[model samples]
Target: MENLESENTPNPRNPKKPKVVIVMGATGAGKSKLAIDLASYFPIEIINADSMQVYKGLDVLTNKVPLEEQKGVPHHLMGIISPNVEFTSKDFRDSAIQIIDDIISRNRLPVIVGGTNYYIQALVSPFLFDDLIEEMDDCCLKESIGDKELEYKFASGNDNCNVDYQRLKEIDPDAANRIHPNDFRKINQYLGLYARSGLLPSKLFQGQKWGRTDNFKYDCCFVCVDASLHVLDHYVEERVDCMINAGLLHEVYDIYSLNADYTRGLRQAIGVREFEDFLGFYLDKDYNADTERIILSTEDKMSKENLKALLESDNIPHKDLLMESINRLKANTKRLVRRQKRMLNRLQALFGWDLHYVDSTESLLGNSYDSWPRQVVEPSVDLIRSFLHEDNCTVPTKIPNAVASQILDKRDLWTQHVCEPCGNRILRGAYEWEQHKKGRGHRKRMLSLKKSKQYLVDKEAEAVT
Candidate 1:
């Protein structure tokens, strides 16, 4: 319910160090536009903090700023890495800090913006990697290194430990289950943390000072672009429609031809992998990462009529498939938005005074400042200017209970299952899940599962007889 609130923290904006503005928001909350609009008020270059946007290609799925929309403002870290390479949060922190320093040297502002909560959190806060990397440098902390040089010490870390994802599960099941079994890099990190430091990765991470990491020390403020849940849901659908209109299918197909691994890097982008079923349905896939993934059916050779008939014969409606992709994408995006809201709340709880909130509900469809009323936009811009020009600025800090309740005590929300026979609605909590099980729809699924099992058993018996 509070309007234009900010937190006053210990961070003092020094003239020597460059001022950085971090824009935090969910997928469709217009973060990019806000960062660009700040250029009108101050000299600013954007440093992208989104994980997917770090990779090259699949721009549509990443919601990258198209050339026309960039408005000639210089941006860094967007569409820069190969899709096949695994880019981690530590890599982002190191690279972004260097870039921020460089921008400050040139007397220009560096603004960190995007949807990846972890990436933004790492860059804006005291990151776990800073401690880990520093500890690695200190031969005193790690006995296994035993006076060995920094570069050579961790050279054979994986081989020496022979640790894998399973070991991580034994040590830290909570962290392991959240990560994919195939994410060996993170698994190794967790394993290394435990082996060298005698600390759980999860505990080390939580115990670190959030938002004020020692290595990445820059005077910064967080501007969160937020909206009502209903409004964000609407914008997500609109953005998806725009992506569809902008040839998202062809974009994914283009990356597919590159044989990018979905389990790693940019190919893991939401829209890219979600359309795999549709792409696999239409096109022949020889998509091995080590080999070329060429499209066998060229547009010139494959007639629309022929493709339609083949899918029809297979009982797969092209229109229906597209709709299903759209719907699934919407669901995933909305879930992401919800998670983002909660993560931002974490920032508020930790860095209470440094975070600021800007209501973007009204500015959904238009450019940043122009879309907002003069009253709101002017003061907001002034607040930012004061941060940039002055040492510190004071603004009211407010956290609505409604926002806090949105994410409180809901760790298992994502793991909850939906009742497929009961309209496939998501069960968000244990109570909802229990209620669904007791409801007619869940009972129907139970009956269906039972019947299917019985039918299989009967068929086997008949074969034996």
Candidate 2:
């Protein structure tokens, strides 16, 4: 570890916090490109913040920047974790912090870039509520639940384990009301927090200064490379198409198994789940000797068209399923783009983090290859340069809005609501609750309940007469 005192020293204005640059955006939004381009201006190392990219395998599915494309710049924490292990946000935060420290130690700028906002959130915020949940999973839960017993019950779903949830409800109904009964992790965490500290987690942890800007560990220059949804949606679809052309199926095929858990590890990526139906059908032994020969013949190529033709000639239903699976992959990737954008907005609006937005819509729509440097990279570089120089001229100071600051505290974002009229469907947050109220199903249920009440009243009066 090469130690460099120059860049590691605290800024004169804010002596406590060191500078770190974070590049964030939606999927297929050129966040990696922008971050890599920054290396020309400043000595920097890139840390992968995207959750999927951290896991090994499925490089095409995760869209990791290839070694040649990385332009000889050092990138850390990408494709290092085992494909089967569940790497939590705390895992990312801890690893990234160590990498960032090393980068700063060497006098290189630490440029953390990815679409995973929670990973970034966990990195920036010193004491996130999610950290408590992670802590419980690590240290606290073992003491409260008994380590080996917890492992057994968590894996087997023992009926007697409801004792922990019931205990949580008894101690803190407010916390218990928010978490679902089956969510053993949170149930145990809340119980662990209460038992360990003798304090209600609902009151103590619900809405602390977790994601606030002032409470962040470092002075961060947040750069979001964003574009219009229409452009991003089109780009995401195109990228998925390109990934398919680039042996994405082959990557997925190598990892496919009959008993593979889709909810865990790299299998949870969008591309993997969408192809389960097709893979299950293709891999089934009952498909006959001819189908098996066709499958074995195309093992090397694994071309989508080749698979489609085999399915079409043998079974038309299987062919349609394959096509639908490919379409689903594209659709799911687009949905991920939208979701990542929404989270970025939430971080800015709710958390009061000063995010410098560089709109790439125009460049993406026009001559992207030529204009990308000007529209996205150059503007992001300027913001970061100003940030490094401690110039407030280009950067706006974050003014914590009192109402917005307290909103999470006053109303827990994780607070759950169950609508009994709507078949006991659970909804989280005020926004989701309001949306459920306006939904047709909820309205119909309420109307039926009202009519039933009126009919019962009429029947009772007739009986009395």
Candidate 3:
């Protein structure tokens, strides 16, 4: 590996904490722009930590930095996996470690960049995720649930897993009792493990990586880029507009069609699975490829003729369906922003050592938002370089605002978010969150917020002093 001295050094004998750099933030906090710019000035090659961008295609929706913008810097692990395949956190950690070590050996700074926070944690803190979750199917049960049915049950997200919980209790009561009836996700895993491996997740991991062994195989500094919430929402809205203008709907349709109703692994990408309603609208019905094209065109803002045809053919207004997709995309993204903020909080709580934050709100709200300036990238790059040259304290547990952390924690009502601006409106989910932002009351509050210049404290950052 390169002889670059990292700020946070582990035990000399530990091979885990290799020197590396990381850039992370919410959905539209300019992580890509800053990363590419840093690469321009330093000997850095970006190794993607984003789960969605690792898949091929859907560049616009994923908000991938374009080649022309990269300015000839090499980026690894981006758009390489097939969207049809399941790419887990483990897949990323394995692939990225190999790529990072390779870059270091080439005398280049290996920079891990993306919104996927878990991947970053896995890199710097070994077994960052719960060790019980198996990376691949290890259980060998005689009778297993079919994939489609399993997917349906999981996706349904109801509290109907009580029976499975009961069955699991008889077989593996420890694991079953640990999971809640409503948490089908955990229940399914517990039941599935016992059915296949005749053991609980904890028991199955007899010798595998589990618990804190201090074996993180890389040394890294996480650059958390952020903006005020009001500022971020505007940026997100602008990106959504750019996505729409850049044929986002068509991209979703193309990938959705290509996957042909088998939306696995990559379906979690922001916009893909959100199109469930539109896709399900035609699931049982069949149409030729050409007819499918005409129907899809109706959703395109540019397809005037298709719009006319849609109005004439279906009793429901084409505008309504298209708006449904648009509304969904927007709301889901806002919730993503919220969730990402929470992830940042968790990171702050767990590994506060040598973690630096770059708040570029004023710059992002500058006369030109997309135009990169020194303010955005220089400080972060300098900090990273400093990490290479200086000795920094190991990650600490001194949480900034423990009290605020408790208050800011989200209490979702069946995956919901509450917006205080609009009649204390309860946003049922992402679609409602996005639409609420654009609604009269929310926009009115946004303008008020901008005028007041009362920057919304990053809800998650409340964990910090």
Candidate 4:
């Protein structure tokens, strides 16, 4: 793609930099172990790419790497935000890029490891929010009033708030086909941009060049952890059990007390949601007992005793109830495994990665024929090392200290110049400005504003020719 060079670089060889290695896989796929093993041999820092793990106080629930497990190796992007705060992919991309540059400056290999596919894609893809937002902004301001009317005016002129798939089809047929019709968020993002910018988000991203042309960038290999259906089911069951033993119920209870929004976010989490149900049932039993005791008359002693005796007798069937609970847990675990498998398949297809099925093994070193450690783990590490050393492999171009220092200084200068509204580094082009205004959140904000009288007046003035 496009390469931005430092002015002081007289020779391309012997560049002052190291490669970035990314380790990606599904949840519970042993990514952390592989990352640690690779970091042991190289001057590497692990950057957490998981979305949920970035939040604080979710160490056990999110499976964040413990401080001791870091093995004195630096880890970035973990526990940086409170659980109450919502994090978006753009926020992740900005932080990750800054950290990656810092790591390279220190001559350390940046190894990004996580299961969050969107965050990883944001890092590797040529599409940057800075440019996209700029393009969207310009488009949003320049569109003809007539054009906006044609786009926004549905057959019934009902404002078309749900997103128009047909508009997306006109702009990017491929994207329209890939995105489900019911996926309102993505659909709205594309359609809303098209209505304002007259350009599709997918089309804006197609074939765009990236400044970082490091061979290591494209040379990065993806190794997906695969397992048989039965094995995966068993693995999920064991994992859920471990989570419960780790006090997942208590974690959910703690989160529930924070706020409705916090509870909603936790409920949306995988294992946390199931555990919340368990907690809800437990609380409901206590609530029912309290309600009964409050409503029952103390003078009706015989009736109250009969009711208490009935409940006590019913509660005696503990073993049967425990068996039922176990069965339900097993079933839920199976469902979760199936969902994970589907998500893995979808991400694998999108990224075109090499999937390696690793059999369960006790040790990292075992029989090459049967174990994940021997067959998948070691081979991946070998590939990373080979890519880093190969002469033809694209290492980031080296720059002289003077030129590199100048570029770093320029970056800092522009840091404060970044858009305060979108919180991204400002783009140089008008086209990019237009794209940002049409992005999902911006458009959603605009629509929300249109409902208010004061905002309506401002919007009207802005729309005036």
The candidate scoring highest on TM-score is 2
- Mind giving the per-residue lDDT tens digits that candidate 2 earns over 1-465? 223256456557856566888999888778998988888888889999988999999999899999999998899999999999988888898888898888876778899999989899889888865566556656754576565545544533445547777766887887887887767667766665665445688788555777888898987888988899889888877887788778787887777765566757899888888888787777643334554432344444444446535534766767777778889998988878867876775676566777888888877787657678888878887787777765342755343467556754454455788899887887776756775698777899899999999999999999999
* Model 4, TM vs. native: 0.60
lDDT of 1 at 344: 74
What are the runs in model 4 whose C-alpha is more than 4 Å off? 1-18, 128-131, 139-184, 200-219, 257-267, 284-373, 391-465
Clashes of each: 5, 0, 14, 20
The model with the greater lDDT, 3 or 4, is: 3
Q: How many clashing residue pairs, candidate 2?
A: 0
What CA RMSD would candidate 1 show?
8.8
Score every model by TM-score.
0.71, 0.77, 0.66, 0.60
Return the candidate ranking by lDDT, descending.
2, 1, 3, 4
Worst 10 residues of 3 by lDDT: 205-214
Best by lDDT: 2
lDDT tens digits, residues 164-222, model 1?
A: 66677787766665566677666766666666666666766645555532334666766
The list of candidate 2 runs beyond 4 A from truth reads: 1-7, 10-14, 128-188, 194-200, 286-315, 367-370, 391-393, 397-411, 417-427, 431-465
Return the lDDT, model 4, position 278.
Answer: 36
- Residue-wise C-alpha lDDT for candidate 3, range 1-465, written one tens digit per residue: 224434333446754456777788898888887888786567788888888899898998998888898888899988999887877676787788788767766777888889887777676656533343353344333335446335434534445567666766676654554445566556666655544444455455333332212344555576878888888888788888778777676677666653344325666688887665664453333446765632333442343234223324653744566667767888889888988886675455433334577777877688666434656776776676666775442333235445434422432212355676566665543434654676676898878877665445554366575
